[model samples]
Target chain A: MLITGIKSRPVYDRLAPMASGLRHLAIAQGSGGQPMLRLLADMTPAQRGVATVVYSSESFTGNSYEAELRAVDGIDLRLCASNVEALQVLDDLLSTAKMGTRLYLAGSEGFIGTAMQRATEYGLDRDEILREHAGSFVRRVWCAHCNAYTENVTQRIFRCPGCGLDLVVRDHYSSRLAAFQGVKADGEVPGELPEIEELDT
Target chain B: MTPTAEPTAFTTDETYTPEGAYTFRNSREGVRRLPFPFPDDEYMYSMNLEPHVPAGDGAMRAAFDIDEHYISECHHRAQMLEAMPGVHYLALPHMMEAQWDLLELIFESYARDYPEHFTLTKTGNEWHWQNRLLGIDDTFTFGDPTTLPLEPMEYATRQAQGEFVVLEERDNDLVIGAGMTTQRADYSLRFNLGMRFFEFHGPVPKLHEMGILDRALKFLLRMKPGHPVRRVNWSLTVNPRLETSVETLPEWAPDRATVDAENAGERVYLRIELQPLHRLPRSNAIVFPVRTYLVSLAELVEHAPDWAKRIHRALASLDPELVDYKGFHRYHAAAVAWLAQHDDGAPLATGYPWAEGGIQPGD
Candidate 1:
């Protein structure tokens, strides 16, 4: 099955269990920082074949023990001088992995997309692809002065609190589930689920 | 150049082939989903870790299934996002103090490569970035006072007109007061970085600025050593100025006219007063600011939906390039699932299924 969009959640959820099954498990974290390593240490056994990758940046250096693990596991954990360098290293390692092998891509959407393209070019089938988008959307309301969001009628009537523009609700669904949830025609709640406090708000 | 061949240092004695990739399958039923779980509720939340090989064992298992599964999932997510245009995923702890240096490097690369597309700013107390092409003016409120006085004092003394008159005198006690003000608003995206802590005075007596004096004297003759000194009674009073922003903030510049007009030319303000007590002692008082930030995207997303969508797409697109893609997925999923499982009936916004209602767990 060519898993993409929302279809990939099931696959992503099993990462920890799958890693446990490997004889020599390698975990790579791009150059965010030591938090990833601490999280990994808290989640996995030290005896597991665990390797980490860390890419250094101006604000951070991937010189910790966790970073070493990433390089040893055939992952590039150093800060790339340019986007091109980052794409190149990611492409090389992903392509070298054997076919039918499950590859886990974690990080920003841009990083995942680049790696996916490289993997496909290297002979991985579309069915082998799975993804989860991890970011919030930037919502722009209709400003009476700006006259934005006039295109979508369903979002009409509301005025921009910022600029008093005729506001229209814009959908910023990064994940397939979010997109699916955005499409409900009626006010009927999904599955009669109880309301949760808006923690993000 | 082909990679140089180097002897692989095996951390463990065990070795295994890369086959049986198909042996691991996604069991949908086995997976659990819940809404975002709060850190405060210890009963419903738990974290566990285990080693693949037993400690002190010479030859241990080469790999653990869970680790492989995490890697595979990360790869899958990357591919999925690649198919979707303008979406990105981000691994977090990006700017946590311990990880700030490394995350900053990654951010700089993105900024350099996509200068026109990305802009970084401080919102609330945190730092965040967004694609400038979206043309969304992220709004944030910052009317809190930056500095406040720890305490204020008042003193009174009485003098006699003639040398023979021994008039009794009393002293007024000291009083302390605190004030705070919300300053202004900026692009909300900056809040993602963190918050700055301001000085918050605790109890008034703790400030160490209260004291009294003892003196003794004879009316007709020169005073001798060890003469008894008359004790004067002392008392205190506190009056705090609540509306002090008018004097605190300087005259508005041409650029601030719009914001000042919007807020009725008034800044948000908060103040507290401490009444004086007789028994307190005199000591040096210290006032320091304690800073913190709130890095939430919800408010900005609500006000500027289109801009939020554009930034979301840009972030989604960048996911694969980031490390720990799998870890981010797990954390996000778990947060959503925990929210789903525990949501009580409350009003919430769209997109956040877990927060569709106002039922949030205690912190």
Candidate 2:
């Protein structure tokens, strides 16, 4: 894999059990279930007793380990059909989460970014969370012209559904917006655009 | 050098319009004070910072400079913000304390330096600010957002002339949490609001590997509350338009194509930002104020021939990646060629390029 040299991109870590944490919340989506299971297996019985898992079946690549995750014993599991529902479950759990809680996130870039945003809302620092990337690198882009977010974007140039302008996705990522930036493709000269190609996904 | 049409008349008392025949060039005082960044005959990225204490002539005399274009730039910023609402100003939930700190800093600076134009009075948190230039006189309780028409940071930035961003230090890293960025070079405040120092500078080439940002961040982290630091960063703009933000690329990006060697003198502009970073007393956040100064290529060649020679060499020696990153790659060749005519390739002095007869430090 070629590293794109995009420093703004969040670095993903491998999921593992932190022995120091008294409570654990593991949130996973799609292909992320494998890492979540691995993390749960690494945890001791006491850690599992205090763990809450939220798994979303949504997968861009159609990979699922929900059954395997459910088969695991001695832990609480909450399953959802979509990533949004899984996020809601995480939110509800985090609202009452204590200081000793350690969060583990596994999924695509967009999933981790949105989950990190929610974690930031409740004043969770980087030390309190560990994120592992699992799925493809389809980007969630924010259109500069119309301020609309288009998710799962794989192409460099696409028409913004919000304002209907042909936008070229810049390699720069915004952790605040939890999305990559997209500006007008032919902004310099109308109807004249640079060559289009697939993103480095 | 070829002769261009003379700029319009400008005076401090009169209303200066940005569209009014380039009034910036006509102000001899302002032209002499232009903070030309190229003291050497070459350009490169570095932590070229200095104490923000008063130094040099006009522009460097104060931490915040309110020049002849102050009113015009403020009016233009208001119009840009209104046209592009919600994109120029943003503050996260935790940045409110820093906002008030920034408001107090600007208010105190302006009132003390330009007493004729601004006055700030405080009596146990009941504050009164008066801006004679904009005819603004209002009273509000300190640290209260509901008392003011706009948020504290936005209110202060609206009256000031340039871009302002507040960076909060956390986990040994500074995060850009709040800003009023109507006049950014080519970035969006909304998108870059929560970025760390190195992350925001990620688009620029070669700065990270060279450890420039690392050193710069270290220097900023050590800045004390009372002491401030300043640096000069330059880029080229198609016109004297202040709103060169990425969101409005469709409007101003096309103007690059309209420039050729013949018209490059009039069309191309040297956009210099006087970035002054100050640590807020209360919030301990660093308030980065980017005070912009624009001089046209023609104005440089016409008024200061020494500047033309130095700029020619600086632009010619610029890294290809930097030229492309500055968004002037389209007209880079034409500009270099046009600036070549004014350069005799002579060596210049080794200090800040102050114009002849301009006041130097300790003069």
Candidate 2 residue lDDT tens string, B135-227: 999999998899999999999999998899999998889999998998887788889989999889878888888998889999999999989
Interface RMSD of 2: 4.7
TM-score of 1: 0.20
Error of 1 at B230 (Å): 99
The worst-scoring run of ten residues by lDDT in candidate 1 chain B lies at B154-163
What DockQ was computed for model 2?
A: 0.55
| lDDT score for residue A36 of model 2 | 97
lDDT of 1 by residue, B298-347 (tens): 22133322322322332233333121211122122222232232333333
- DockQ numbers for every candidate? 0.01, 0.55
Instruction: Please write out the lDDT profile of model 2 over residues A65-158, one tens digit for every residue.
Output: 9999999999999999999999999999999999899999999899999999999898888988999999899999999888999989999889
Q: Which stretches of candidate 2 lie over 4 Å from their true place?
A: A1-4, B1-26, B354-363
Q: TM-score of chain B, per candidate?
A: 0.15, 0.91
List TM-scores for all candidates, in order: 0.20, 0.93
